[model samples]
Target: MLSDTGYPGAVGSDTYDLIDRQLVHALQLAPRAAFSRLAAVLGVSDQTVARRYGRLRGAGAVRVLGLTDPERLGEARWQLRVRCAPDSAGAVAAALARREDTVWVSLNSGGTEISCTTRTPPERADHSLLLQHLPRTPSVLSVAAHCVLHTFFGGAQSLVAKSGALSAEQVAALAPDGPETAGSDSPVPELDATDRRLLGVLAVDGRAPLAELAAACGKSESTVRRRLEELTSSGALYFDLDVDWRIFGLRSHTCLWLNVVPSELAAAGEALAAHPEVAYACATTGPSNLHAVVITRGARELYTYLTTRVAALSGVQHVETAPTIRTVKGPGPLPLPSPRDI
Candidate 1:
């Protein structure tokens, strides 16, 4: 157990892994689940859960926060395809990724496009505001901004499920037809090589035209469309509307990692994540028990936020903020190579 001094050495890595997977799974199952319920179901003491969770936060493995809907909150989302000069893509991407409004950023096709997601604040985040930062960045050849109409991936869930611990019977008992399988937080559908390839493409560009994706995957657009529909329906994939965060007057981004009193974690987590500033929240294995990515507009705004704001919530024992200097690779499709791909 971390001493009051915060040694963080009492909980070992093995213990953290077991609970971390379980925590994410539980979250996958129910985003707003209280820690007490999760601990009871997972068969661990609440204090242990809290201790280990603190460790996970220290490890930067997970975060718990509210997934705000920008459109509902009166903001717009955009995808920027930035083209930079040779060897300059990395630098340009680094600069662009640092802004609080830049939620997601990545380089693809050997850096031809530095893809990113940004929220347009109601007053300051117009298309030109986006370009305004790039000209000063150097080596920014061109920038293409696509207004996001739909999302196929990357929305934060209130909870996650761990399919490893729960049996098919248990899943059926809890939520038989909800959305996921007993042992898989990932929605299930049989995907062929082409389907996997298509996912890879979408991971980079959810807006990839069906014709383009089909050509890359060597399939027809109709076949691609039908397959995509099946994948989404089966819950293997989800759409992302990609709303912008800035317009809603959300001006700051802070990562809040807390070690809640596990006995009260269940109720506390739900209440804490549901708070307004929390934009992406998750419960994971802990040393940093809970990780919450918060948003606000400026320094003064954030100062008012934590001091006059979130500090009032109950069950919060510890909170730390890491001003995000950059998001190297923002959350999107986390597709990975199967064992064979190795």
Candidate 2:
């Protein structure tokens, strides 16, 4: 079985050394920064930075992914909660994981509940899997779809950046060049064919070399570089690092479904967003208007957080905690497990 660290039975492999943590934090700030740039910022040799990243990637502990902001693309993002027959939960989750539109698929609630996030383009909203296939599945007992209204945290934000592995100066030094001031009112740039092709390659590997991206998108390197800058600057595309939290000594992962007074929803969400334990938090349309993913050291720590920090939040009427049993997919594409592993 894969251990909590997402490594296959590697004892003590989850603990990242100081350099490793620093490197991760650096990448969290600038995911596509050249190795030489990262090394210089981290005060290490370029070879060392590259070697450490290679090791982390080979161990399945980290991945850099370039993802489009669904809101910028005028797409609807949904958080799906599916309750299934106990025996079919794993299979159902596996199916969801294989879908390109779905991410963060996990088994929860004693292997009978599945939670996932899916993006649906406006053109396909009526025909989405949430609207059609899941409701019709015999094994699915119920499906609750929550439309994400606003994100208080997550997306380009990384927990690694909050680790304090790098100093303020280091973070500033590695920051991408540009004035990123895109707001809700910023004009959404329409993506063309080349832009789509470029994003397709980056979706798999955010750090893919410029030459490779140019070839895949059928554009010159200079054009590809300029287009990438435009997309990022416009807040249409952002890079994220998918890493196992256990590497940071966080061994427990849970989803928090909270019902808060509508008047205080924004306040509560902003508060939760500030907590280090929260990996993702957003406002959604549902009985539980606020949802968050939290990471902690273990079950005991999770309990403490709920009893202390979470309990201290104002206007929370109800809270439901669903600890993840296993992740079927994360932010990046994940290989399906073998039948034996499943």
Candidate 3:
């Protein structure tokens, strides 16, 4: 089900027969969109949507994840591009996929190359380790990684149209079954400039203190608190975990880009995500169709992990690796109004 790198996918592989292309389609529209609402648009029952969504999450086909704004949040993110010996490259790619902090990995262009991503405290990890740690391995030939100053979703959901086209059942699915809803209307939160700024701050720094943020933004402590509450209540914000892979002792880092058979796409994706090293895997619209990020303690440990672990997975035809250089931001921030206007 896999092919050599740079082998044009147009040549046809069984990878396109995906199970829940709908899930990916939904995510591209609203990453955190409620499953109930999605059921309506997809013409499926609410519970079915929920169950399938759970399956998609389990399979790694649809990542309904959120990104924190790194800029205002006082953190940085980065990417690593690894070039390893062609023969040992798949082993290296598998090795890097195991880390918790690896955002994604991919083998692209050909088997000689790979790429890995991570989010970390800005400028903290030894840049040399980020670059040198993996390539130093016996199987590795060369490596390159760059700390990302900024990262943004390429808007994959827009690939699917009709965002608000939920079915009637789907609309009811969004309703909370509470006595208050019997007679009273559920409150919908409103956002203003301060609300937006407060969200922007948290988007970048989840740990930013309310008092400090208020002071920095020139608003009252209570006002900031209320704004935060309102925005979160409105579902305008979501939380996620962020860690530095190295400090977390997940030292071996690499990106894996895999080409799977069309018939095997769903199974291959599910298998990859189920692996502990396959921290984040996604079927994007691209070359190394399947991408993942993995982490390990060091080179020796990573080598064993790849060959003995990842190389054994079925439907995995080819793999490549790119050792990371460094991470400037993890998942930190999104755009905010100028002058820190909240």
Per-residue lDDT for 77-104 in model 1, tens only? 7766577786887777766655656656
> What shift in Å separates residue 21 of candidate 3 from its native position after superposition?
38
**Residue 13 error, candidate 2, Å:** 3.7
Candidate 2 local accuracy as lDDT?
Answer: 0.85
**Which parts of model 3 are misplaced by more than 4 Å?**
1-192, 214-235, 333-342
Which prediction has more favorable TM-score, 1 or 2? 2
lDDT of each: 0.54, 0.85, 0.50
CA error at residue 43 for candidate 3, angstroms:
50
Cand. 1 TM to true fold = 0.44
State residue 157's C-alpha deviation in candidate 1, in Å.
Answer: 5.1
Best by lDDT: 2
Top model number, TM-score: 2
Off by over 4 Å in 1: 1-187, 241-244, 247-249, 333-342
Q: Total clashing residue pairs per candidate?
A: 58, 0, 58
Candidate 1, poorest ten consecutive residues by summed lDDT: 1-10
Tens-digit lDDT string for candidate 2 (1-342): 675534333236345788888888888888888899999988889999999998786666777889888878888899999999999998899889888899999988788999999998888868469878899988999999999999999988777877888999998898767665377778767898999899988887899999999999888999999998889878899899888775677778899999999999999999999999999999999999999999888899999999998999999999999998887788867643435455
- CA error at residue 98 for candidate 2, angstroms: 0.9
lDDT of 3 by residue, 227-319 (tens): 655444444444443332321234455666677666676666767666655555555433455666656667687688679777876777888
